[model samples]
Target chain A: MAKTITQEFTKGLWDEIPPFRLVLGLCPVLAVTKSVENGLGMGVAVVFVLVCSNMLVSLLRNIIPSKVRIACFIVIIATFVIVVELLMQAYAYPLFLKLGIFIPLIVVNCVVLGRAEAFAYKNGPVRSIVDGFGIGIGFTISLTALGALREVFGSGTFFGMSVFGPSFQPFTFMVEAPGAFVCLGLMLSLMNLAGNK
Target chain B: MVDNNMVDTNKFIVSHAPFWHDGSKISTRNYNIALAALPAILLGIIFYGMPAVGVISLSISSAIIWEFVFRRVTKRSNTIGDGSAAIIGMLFGMLLPATAPWWLVILGTFVAVVIGKQIYGGIGANPFNPVVVAIAILMISWKDLFDFNEALMNYDFDFAMVYPLAALKHFGVSAVDSFNAGDLLMGKQSGGIGSTFGLGLIAGGIYLIIRGIIRWEIALSFLAGVFITALIFNMTDSARYAGPVIHLFAGYTLIGAFFLATEDSSSPVNFIPMLIYGVGAGFLTVLIRNIGVYVDGVIFAILIMNLTSPLLDKIKPKAIGKAA
Candidate 1:
């Protein structure tokens, strides 16, 4: 049981990463990931929610009826989402502002809901929590990777620090939507090649 | 597996068996999409008045005309009846402001159909969303054309509604006092031609969903991502940022999320990946809107997501029973 829990938590990091591997919670990964800091903040928020939601869902898996499970699950998921929203407002106001609608939009992120259905419902509490942590960590790392790449190339900044020499001019397009998609595509392909290896 | 080339060769010979039947009739799916854009057309005219009509007409006309010219120049068969060019024009028009220069609108149509759509072998073959690609080209090449401040500076008594960007530009980047949230929602604000009129845009969106031209997942997730982000920003500092409602209605959020970004050819076909595409567009739209120096997020968002549609298609989960 202990080994299973460890495996579940670690899976989300690479084998079932929410962004690069599983391709879940992409809304924020692509949206606010213009800067490394924004990506880190979003990843942390998602991980927090994933861990809490997974634990709660695992605890109540038996009591929740299969017939109306999705609706009940949404309520449970939404409660955690609201808590995340409030916590962001209370503590990380600037990051909260930066993430914007994305925090509440987490309710619809599919990764959270996908995990609830796939892992938490059938797993024990300890396993579920670890699973969530792994997935969240995986998601955070991927987002930060993409964000750092885009930010450095698009804006000549690394996590908001200027790294380029004076002659280096940022590619404005990299900071925009086109840059985001191109970066994501390249990242996914790289991951796919690595995974295949 | 059946050979695709052999299948095509057989189709030309008119394979009689129903299992092997294939036809060359041009698909009307694109035309049906144009028909769906009618509600957005009506809403634009009603809210922004006659200038809106002129912009749409010019765009559509330029698009169709450009399509004919491109076919002639390329020595390719004419595809005017396909309605793909017309759809591109209408969508491009829907994204521009009512006050945009007529020639620029024509240029936008030309770039959309000629370069963005037709250059890649027309319509479905195009890799980027046509409207967004055109808008981006126009924006990067003709900076003054997209300056909403100049266009909306007059502030006529009846049209005093301050567009989000105009307000932002007028008040400078740091000041938030000039923004009027009401103007943004009610469509009295100055922005893109068809993106305003919040209620009217929603009505158009609902029509598309009801007609089965679009799924609610992409539309809803896009809105959810954008709205949630905007709400958080507003809560953190309402002074510098407008609320979610304003962000949604201020510009092409409704039209783009519902009609433009949802273009079948430029989007993914699978359900889960399709939702990802929509949410990605929505999140990008909001991110660009708040942080970037610009007022509009729709065009950039759509173009960016369009680039990923192929990747999204590749990732679509195989049906439960299908072999991976």
Candidate 2:
């Protein structure tokens, strides 16, 4: 039984990663992942929201009615998202500004609400927390990787520091909106190829 | 054994559709295209000097190399023998200025071969013209590189150094009067390396049409569309818009009508769709030249038309045996 629970936790990390596997919560993935810093900030905020919302939803699962479950899930998720938004505004204002509407937009992010309905509502508190951590961390890794790739290629910088020689002409396209889609698509294809092998 | 052999000979052979041999291969078509483009290319080389040769050669070799390497990596059959890469290289090089840098040529060919063609499954599978895709990306990325006036700044010409399109764009129609109709036709004006050779382009276009390599309908309708649209615009405001003749002779008008707009994979196949597609591209080219940000609208115009090719191809005439 414990092994099965552990499987549920680890599955989100690779077996069912949010962005690459399930393709959930692409709004934040595509929106704020222009730089490593922004991606990290967004990732941590999502983690906080996911873990909290998942736990709370699991705790109240027995008491909550099945018919209005989606509304309940939304309220719970929105509360956490607001909390993350305010905390970021207070503590990390630069990142808060960078993230812009996406922080508030996380209220509707499918990942959080998806976890609440799909896993947390049926699972116990501890398992739900584990699942949230796994999924959140998975999302963080993917976002950070995408950010790093775009940043290094687009600007010849990683984390705002020059990684390439001065002669290196930045690919500039990788950081633009079209570049975002192309980068994500190539990454998805690479992941599929790797997974198949 | 003899009885078995006789029985095997009597069995019908199962083969895929297109059993009839037309003797048309990709290599034959590509080689013909290369031949068709030679006049403009030679004219460009004569006018632009050694740099034109360098850009053209590098672009061709690099495109072929990129395609070869991609096929090797993907474990697909080598398609470099078909000469499509060379044609793409030639077309892309024609669109570039003689002053184009080596790095820009390499980058453009890489984009044309790898990103534009191979990534979409190569050759006939690509929805867009590989050269147009590369040129569009390059234009967007490095606007100054493609700016004929800026790129050709070093050269001291006997005539005005100003590219006619740029002159028309910035200084109204009267500014283009400096470029005589005869000179523009003879390729004395400044523009893209091969595109400026209006007479050569027309001859090459005519040759391709005669050989039946490209449909006469597309080339004619495209030019007609441009002529009619430019004439309308010229009539509306003679002071602002250049005449249809000037529009035809200058910029990428001639080359685009012949080569870029008729790329097989990205263009319509049927009769009505071909006319509509060609006309639409020609009309859009004039519209963009008049109003859009880009100086020459041919690249974007053809790309826009390429997007509509699938939809235009859907406009088929009724089949003869269909239920009434």
Instruction: Give the number of the best model, judged by lDDT.
Output: 2
TM-score of each: 0.55, 0.91
lDDT per residue as tens, model 2, B1-324: 111111112355322121223357767778888998898999889888999999999999999999899788666677888788999999999999999989899989988998888887777767898999999888877787878989988878687877899889998888888788789988888878888888888888888888777878888888988999999999999988898988788898999999989887788888998999889988998999987877888889999999998889778778799985
lDDT of 1 by residue, B106-189 (tens): 867876887687766665567788888888867765565566656645546465556565465356434434445565555666
The sequence of per-residue lDDT tens digits that candidate 2 reaches over residues A73-103 is 9998889889998999999999999999999
Off by over 4 Å in 1: A1-197, B1-32, B46-50, B154-159, B169-185, B319-324
lDDT of each: 0.75, 0.86
Chain B superposition TM-score per model: 0.83, 0.92
Native-referenced Cα lDDT, model 2: 0.86
lDDT of 1 by residue, A86-185 (tens): 9989998998888898888988888989999998999889889988899888888998998899888677888778988776546566678766775786
- Kindly report which residue stretches of model 2 are placed more than 4 angstroms away from their true locations once superposed: A1-10, A163-169, B1-22
Cα error, residue B242 of model 2, in Å, equals 1.3
